[model samples]
Target: MEKPAELQAANYDLVARDTKSVGAYVKSGAPYVWVTAAAISVAFIITVALLLLTAARGLPHFWPADLVQATYKEPGKEQQHLLAEIRSSEEVTTARLLNAGLPVDEKQPLYDRLLLKIANRDLGGVDFRYVLSDWLVERSQPKDATVLERMEWGNFHGFVVALKEGDKVVASGEEAWKGYQERQDRVNDLRGKVRDIEKGKIGAVNYDLERLRLQQRRLELDGKTPERNAADFAAIEAKRKSENEKYEVLRTELDQLNAEMGRDALVMKTVDGQEVTLPLSKLIQGYRPNDMGLFPKIGFFLGAIWHFVSEEPREANTEGGIFPAIFGTVMMVMIMSVIVTPFGILAALYLREYAKQGPLTQAIRIAVNNLAGVPSIVFGMFGLGFFVYFVGANIDKALYQEGLPSPTFGTPGILWASLTLALLTLPVVIVATEEGLARIPRSIREASLALGATKAETLWKVVLPMASPAMMTGLILAIARAAGEVAPLMLVGVVKLAPSLPLDGNVPFVHFERKFMHLGFHIYDVGFQSPNVEAARPLVYATAFLLVLVILLLNLSAIRIRNKLRERYKALEH
Candidate 1:
């Protein structure tokens, strides 16, 4: 064996060799590359995990869960029965349970709790309740249990008691459910007719009446009174009379439809044996969730999803469809793209090809870069003041004087919202377009000019086409940013609910001056501003996932177009 000092000397030599190897590795920058790759992988994983969590929380809500019937045996409390759907579960400390006034044993360290969706808001005055899992007994799913989705209240979970026409009971008990199923289709049809009359024919008549009133006001403003323009005045009066006649007919039809809808009523019995009468007009649908098989449940889930995306909201935006919001978001993004493309391209063209390369141009570029960093709410405020109050007000005074005080265009609207987003995204487009223009070879422009083409023609036919891909890239970024914006839209145009769409079969097909609902704003409202926090939680997740999906789809489309443009122009690079 070697001496102790010699052994220490050998160990020191090995340590020095290992340290040198580590130093060489650091100098080669391998650690930085690995760290960067690791960071990207971690970010990707986190993103996917969050999306999965959101889907887990949201998508299952539409799965038509079995209704649970249970008997509860709480300490020192009388036995009680519960009919609900299991919303969620959690583990709690015994101390926390005791603090909540539950009779939890001191010796127990933890207890399980269940969130039950009771959903009889009218009777129980609440939609959800938490119960101790240990105390629940005799749990089962009854086939006869029914769930009623309503237009006003949240939902009703009970059993079918009777079906009645006016004061006459048409069916009772099990037969009542069969009778309901028989008349369900007819009730839905009548409801559709009522909706059509109210929102279609009657709405058109009302619109015409308003237009006639505005026309009369315009004549007065132009100093063309009945004495000066007898024919015009008489024509307006005749049209008004005709519109009134149409209104009377529509009103009669609407009244008859409403009366027919009110003829039937449904009686439901609660789990605790209390009977309640619900109007058939108020009930949207009813089903026995506990009795559905896998395929039936899947079908119901699909139908529910369709209803969510297709129907207008009801019950404080907590129930029904979000079609209006979806339409508004897409419309706003498209309008913004249209408005931004021209302005952004023109500005980029001027800067890259026409403007002198001096301090002024550099200063302008710096200012644009700074604009992108500014908070979006500031842009919203500027739009409100400049676009709405200044420009829109002036337009209203100049061309829409008949609607002066009401301020037709002098309000926060879809047009102003699009303009605001265009302004917000202008810097992005300008930068991307300029970069693309810079990439076009100087030889290409010269060749086109030498081939007897004017400078303008060369730019329009050659340079712009080649740079189209970059412009699309910028547009994709803009859509991604604008579609998810809630704060700016809230101030500019978005509302909780819009009664009518911005587009219709009416003249001037696109109504730029209309306030509209947006998916981003819908998510914000449903998530934060709702009255029922528990009921709205899952919906919040669903809306967020939907907003992300919309942005992704818009980005994907732009990316596809960009790729095609790149391929088309690939030969020009050579």
Candidate 2:
């Protein structure tokens, strides 16, 4: 063998030759290579932009008052049916009105003219004309009223009574008036009672003292003035306690009565103002059933967009405005990145730095490459069987016996989905990081070693810093892969509509056992399960676009981080 110095010189010459050849190829900028690279980059950017645009279009709008009003218009058939029902009602005097239309006394003629005017004029396209109960018509002057005005003013009962029973009409009107008068009287009486109670409470102590003094004087006059003994004192104390209890009971009753009176007054005021009666609980039950047309569409569009960007907390679904899928996807990606990055980098380091160029390492390299080629669905199956059923079941049994049958960790959830994805991405990350590690100069590592640095120290202080750009590149690739993964997540965690959010105000805030929605699944659901096909098609496109955009964003962030790392390590490149 040649001397060690000579052997070192030969190795250096070989490295120099390889570097020169690589530099020449890079400078040449072959047409095919440049074209392919530019095409890919442009396609990726266009795809991402399209996705974002699609998601934005999917967002709901909530504006323009006219649209809202138009949506509330009843369906045509329903309107016609309501009109027919009103016309057929017995309250309407079809024959008499027809006769009056021909010719009659001035008052009868006026009634005919008014009826004709209302019948001819469209009540703002409101199909059903009110037919007032006979009572309402009798209460008003005969020739001056229109049913539309009565219905619009919350006189439905009066309108119906006027139409149906003429005798009952008079009775109902009198009863309504009487009821109103009685309620008003009761309200006034309660108000007076409350005022009196307030005054009594203020003067109560003085009144009690006077009464006690009068009793003491009576006892003295009767020559029965008791000694200041314990029994006599107890008797006086008991009397005082009884009086105090009576006063307290009276005050509580007065307060309760006052509250009831206030509520009644509110109701009466609302009725007088012609406000539609609706219970507070019913009002808060959900969105109003009537469509406000354009406004609701607009609101839905904006709401969808807000749901897209707000990192969908759990409350997104409950009150019906938020979405949690976007948040879960992001969270899964972050967790996957944490699990894959370091392990990938270390594996790559061993392969590129410490491993010998032998059959064993080469075989390992082939296996890793083949792992990446394995179908993603197969990986999902493996994960489900091994991680979810096997490992998770054991964990559930050991840690959550009390919550048995209701599994804690023994389900396919966000956690399992994330881990499954990490495994699926491991090969990609390893290959990328290995390629990066290979690009690093061997001379730099050797130089560090020569400076009396241990192998670990050299890797930590020198090799790692120089290779950081490559490591970031690997991470970016991993993020891109993880973000777009849907098939695996479907089997693992994704659901149609989870009743509760994964993160809530429960004991353990983040309930990983909970299923989650995903944009991919949303698209699928809309396309396949939506009741209205035509209406849902556009929504499918919108959801698909959003899913694509999310993946693009992750890739873009990774690119940015890689670029920053490149800048930081630029000095070391030489």
Candidate 3:
């Protein structure tokens, strides 16, 4: 074979020529690099486009749009004057409009139509109307046009005809608007007082009364006759009487506030020429949108967004805010994190550091991976059967014998829902933590051992601290998955509406036994199950955006923690 150096040079040249061939380049994954980059770019673009679309559709809903006053005349129907907001515009084929019996030009291929929010739903029996743009005449925004945000009915659009105290007219015309504002402020103050009495004092008294009842029932179940426990019974009765007196006082105050609020009325004349007498109690707010300036509209828009995130849902979950769902979602995720972290860490430690390395260990790892892929609803069913029906039933039977029929812990509630999610996300945490444990250098363990440290001490002080970042990574992933899980929450605990939150001012305040609302389920309920499809559509997008934001916040927190841990332990890795 010639000299060894010459032979190696010949082989290198042959290899270089082979690698330069198209087949070799393809086999080396050189072409795949561009393909992979293109795929990633496409995915990123799609994600950005989706977020922009969601923001476009959802963010504009809060803006106070100008009210349009127009005269609409159809081919065979009477001409009608309309006071409404143009909700949207669409282009429709001329032939389609003709088929729908709308008069349109045959020569034109397409005609524009305006979707108007005719908000006097009570009178029109519908909230929206679609009319050909060509049929609308004399379109203008009237300066005196008023829009009422009402507690009942969707909305009311009209002119402020008069303001009255009971049946007597107090003000009319321009004076009516000022008088109406004063009366509305008074009503708002009264409403605040009424809510304070009802939700604060009345709620507390109710809690006390219920607790006393439960105590008496428990004593009865303990075979302690009223005669034998006369003092205990008397104490409960005395407490009940005290709470009842408080309730009566609050109730009376609430009634007085209601009467005062109802005394004032607004006489509004609609575009249809019918005058409606609306009680001040029914009106949330009234604004002349057409008269609003840019700054005023911006303020109104911000106020609307705040209300959406702060108030509770109303009108079949279509018309109001969704604070309850947001609260419940956050609370459930927090509880699940608290429960899953320790269990996941312990299980991962056993698998990676303590368990015998064998076929059994390999099989167990395979099983944990498979568990992560199981449908989340299956975990819900398991939680229902094992946690609720079995464990919760036992707890209720043992501790809450007096409330046996009511089934406190035995029902689907926040606790069961959290447990279900914890189980669902457990596999992710185990895998992540195991990978973290595997990454720790063996020399670090040996060094600790040589320094006369026990295995447990070394693991506790050195290994776990370094692996903490991975644990946080797993938690971030878990939170992302848990916050958006609607199917399992539906089976476990989430409801259409929760009258009271799980955590409130009641005694033993954190009530895990209470069923609660969730944002994912709220989105589903409003988007697909509401009676008013058009009204609920924007809310669906809004709720979805809120849910995404919540997940992002939770993940960001976890990621920040993970980054800190990584930085703290970066030197140890060397």
Candidate 4:
């Protein structure tokens, strides 16, 4: 009966329109291709838009904006003279405005409020203030207003009342401004010298002294008592005494510089008539933005940007540049790439060139591909358990027993962080390298075999050189992934504030056992954990921008290497 029905349908010799349409769509594959392309286009557009927004928000933080002088009259209080920078403005519902005790008109649906950076932190007790739009009776960028970037108390916004040398007023009016600028430069120079003497020379001596202590401990351990290593102890003692003398000289000079710097102070008057006397040593910079010429403004912008890039972070990392974070991130990523490449390439070679074509080999390949999909946090946990607690702790016990109470390698550090990242990105490298090797024709191997080349030699010379572009591809992917990873790094090595960089003049020079700051972690700390949310807001955008830039630069470098290798082996690839 079924045969009869099939025969009857065949006899009709008519194609169903829906069936034909479905067949045509499957054959062409246009729908799937278009959908994928559309998705990719949308993703690209979103990434570009986000980057633009970050740049708009972050890059302007370094620009020296003119200070605004506004008289804001509160309902119950008298007129408050506000000398601050109008950082930003946003519209909020009238309901929210009223909730904040502002007299918002009930008829108005929304009120525009200004974000003012009231930088007299010592007096105002806050770096930022939000003022009602309606309360502003006067708003002007006063010509004489000055903004002082400080070493402490965040920043100061006021008029230059006078320049004081101790109890006497050395300069006032126009002369005071000029004198303050000149004196500020001298103080900055003195601070630089102090920093050098303390962190460079004195720091090196301290490091050496610690090493000597370790040496003494090691000597004691080698024997049983101090008397057994008496000569070694005497030599170490002499070295320590010499180092201490050098340190004392630096300390005396530092004291002299500090005394000289503290002699001059700036007498600044706020718009409210409250005067703040800041020592020239505490002031990083002073600028009258409202009166700056175009060239001067450009100079100030450039200087500010440079300072952000070169200077150490301060004020809970909500202010100042992220130099240490930048350095650490780049160093960690570079180290990870170095460690992963050889290991990944070797594992890929063993599987591709020598392994038997069996179920086990196939299973291994599957496992590697699956590893790429594993959650990164899982890798972080694995790293903590295996690399740090197991391997690093053992290393510390074996080599640094003298530094025991404070675990050196046992603690989270740059080396462990890099290694953990290497493990996380290994699957990517293995998969890329395997694919590269698979693409190499069997005839190429045969040709090498025909030439009487050993299998190892042939693989190294022919397979590896040809596969280098793919290796670079894998490395680029690894860097892109690792550079932006805050979770794993936070677990492994990253910190909010690294007192010293991993690289310093300490013993072994590259102190990979030190905890370091990272750009991604810095962004996280500022955006979420910072106490001053308003002050930290712009910096969060800025740090995110920098992180993206670092990733882009790393990718570009790898791409450049890949392109070069591809060109060199183009004929072989063909």
Candidate 5:
């Protein structure tokens, strides 16, 4: 062996070399850089995958898949014709089948079963059924099979028997299809006219009547007696009568249109061989999905998507489009952003720019940070108590005493929902704005002051302009949180269904006091509360996808605005 000193020196040299290598690695920051990059990349991949999965499930809901007509017969059961769409399929164990009291072949360890959407809720108590794959003796997609998307009682799947005008047979076979199509076009046009008159003309007139009543009450409160305001009341009364006369004419036209649409009916035969006499006006759409070519299917798919996005929901939001939900979500987010930004920015300005730096200021900053983590539902409760019950009831008592007992603003509504969300997101905005103000170089403020600008002027012009991006960043975060927040909205304003949109032909153009549908609430309602879970499954996925899409869009809009602002103030940084 070598001398002890020489051996010790060699060990020290090796240890020093290793330490130097580690130090160099730490100085380069490669480990942290790689870790950060990996985290970001993984997050991106997960987000993209989640989005793709949502699309795969949700987008297919609109596609016109060919309905399968299968003949199912088990050992002891009679043969049956299954005329329905195969919604899904799964492999089930024989043991599980036995437990459910289903007939199972002992020879087979597993069996395939299909979840079928056998629509025609009027005829069948159940809309979905599970049939063993092995039990289906034969299956076919008949070109003559037709499906009708009705206004009520869900979808009707069958074959067209004949076209009838009153009790007279107008056409049969090929000509019947043509006649039905033509008649359907007329019915659609008539329906549109009725909707316009009912919602636009009549609704606007009703709004004015309510306003006139409020006006009369106001006149009374001001001590302007009937004699003094006789001309005003007379003018109002004249307008009201004129509008009523117009409404009566529209109602007459609507009655005539309904009669015209009711004149024709289609004799449709159900899958179980029951003949259904369906009115032309009751059917929203009738199509043969089995016979549709690729282009036609694409067209049908596009039309389905359009209807889903444009039309009002029906059947407890299990069927039809979610246009109102979409509109409410967007409008509420916009209102919330508007309400939060000014208040948040002002609070931040006062704290950072004007308030003295002390332990008290430090405590406030800490408290604001802590507020960001508070449960959203708590804010909703506060809003309901403070905004709806207290503020709104007082406003009702003061402004519209005539409308007392029937509280106008003393309820959950769009305004309350928006305000609640604003409160929930306020801390985020405040923190972000404060950080943004802090980021402005002291030299910039000094330079502005040197130029004889007031403290407020420097903040208003120089500091705030540069802080715009941060405000947007805060807004982006706020929207990301608020748009998907179902818990707070539930207590604040969202309803399972709304008869009319918050925005309509009503006065003020928007009804802030009205309850509205939200996509998040729609998802929750359809997924949990709907009587038909299997029927509502597709809608749940679709609504979830739409909610995500809406949030993404809101964030993108804010980001675009922020980028433009950043570009405008880019020179200030230099």
Candidate 6:
């Protein structure tokens, strides 16, 4: 008994040493590890949050319904009605409004009023019918028409002038008066020319009429024969027709002169009166929907944060919201995960559990690894060739031949994009799953078999559950990568704006055959294809941040699930 006790000393000593070592490591390193992890996580979260908030703030100026409205109450009288809901209590002067955040030039006084500042520019001058909220009207006071003479919104200057109807002379400034006088001279000359043409035509017609009358009277008074009288009448009629033709030509010329004068008159009247100086195009640009002011900006920012953090459902058809893209991305990733997961797991199981470690297995593993390293763009090309062209064409022919030239399935669509992404990510799933399967202890399998459990039972109950967490991790990574992918989607199924979403209410709903808008594609379209580059820049940044948030959310969820699984399996390790 003493010898047995002594023999056991080595085992007891080894167990005690292991416990002390582990305890020492935990005591020395645990706090630092946790602190570093917390700091990194906080920093990352804060950075993302701030970026999203900034984007929201920048986007709120696109819509201005709450700010102010321009209404033409009468033909010549235009009124700006301010919306009460959107305005702050602080009274803003017209000059302050115009130069709120812009530079002012000394030459332009009208730029001080935001409304006038915008109205002075071409883009802002376009007639807009709007209903302003009450708050905006209350906070904004009428700007003195005289004050506009000195205020400059930007490089341009403003002026006020009184105009005589149809006169080209600006009545306020000396230069304007000179321009007006010049225009008036031109207009007077045009009118004189038109009057002269009209008088000449009238004289010619009168003379022709008199000559015809005289000829008729002479034929009757001289007692001419019927033939002579008829000839005289015909001559008179011909003369009258000729005079009428000449009068018509003169009238036409007069009309042309009048039209030219009218255009000049309009130019003189519109430009010479109370002229507001600004770059014509920039001032007249219409407000967009996103310009909902600070409150909406904050709301949108919070909504975005919630969307990225929580699993709440979103509205399906709101514009400028990330809901549709998020839905499409999740739907596509889920479909891909479902498609690739089984295949990847089965392949891994066969290679690690059933197949012998021979050259064939090694070669297969090498190929899988190589596939993982292949350029994603190459996969996109292959997908376009095989899935979009070959398989899709056949499907189109078989199911949708009635819509023949349209090529429903033969075209790039969400289904094909998902399948292509599935293929591209399959190698990742396979490699991860295989590594997880390989990490399993051989003794677990042996013990299960010795306990009368079949190979399938052991794999399904023990191996699969143990390996599930890792498989999910791989799927998450694949999804994140796929969701952010733009190049492949561009060639396969993306569009600038899809008239209908992929999932909508229709017969046999869920139209995978149609193109869809994606967040990544949206950023691309806004950045490169939009007509308004300056306006689209902020939107691009906002969209990019949203896409990043989506990927992070997916990864975080996957990690959470992995942690839960780890905790559940902890007892097994003991």
Each candidate: what lDDT?
0.91, 0.57, 0.91, 0.89, 0.88, 0.60
Put down candidate 5 lDDT per residue, 400-440, tens digits, no spaces.
78776788888889999999999999999999999888888
Give the higher-TM-score candidate: 1 or 6. Answer: 1
Models sorted by lDDT, best on top: 3, 1, 4, 5, 6, 2
- Candidate 6 on 273-352: residue-level lDDT in tens? 34332211122111122234577656655654454333221212111345556676777777677888888888888988
Write the residue-wise lDDT of candidate 1 on 1-574 in tens digits: 7679989999999878867897877987889999999999999999889888888888887889999999989989999889999999999999998888887899999998999999999888999999989999999999999999988889999999999999999999999998987576677889999989888888788888988999999999989989989999999999999999999988998889889888889999999999999888888889999888999999999999889889999887888888999999999999999999999999999999999999999999999899999899999999999999999999999999998799888999999999999999999999999999999999999999999999899999999999999899888988989888877887888899998999986677789999999998998898889998888888888877777888888999999999999999999989
- Candidate 1 wrongly placed segments (more than 4 Å): 1-37
TM per candidate comes to: 0.93, 0.54, 0.94, 0.94, 0.94, 0.53
Candidate achieving the largest TM-score: 3
lDDT of 4 at 460: 85
lDDT for 111 in candidate 3 is 83
Clashes of 2: 26
TM-score: which is higher, 3 or 5? 3
The parts of candidate 3 lying over 4 Å away from their true place are 1-36, 98-107
For every candidate in turn, the CA RMSD to the true structure comes to: 5.7, 21.1, 3.5, 5.9, 4.5, 23.2
Q: In candidate 4, what residue range of length 10 has the lowest lDDT sum? A: 11-20
How accurate locally is residue 503 in candidate 3, as Cα lDDT from 0 to 100?
Answer: 96
Model 2 residue 277 CA deviation in Å: 8.6
Candidate 3 backbone collisions, by pair: none
lDDT per residue (tens digit) for residues 15-88 in model 2? 78866796666766775698999999999999778766765555422111110110112222221211111222
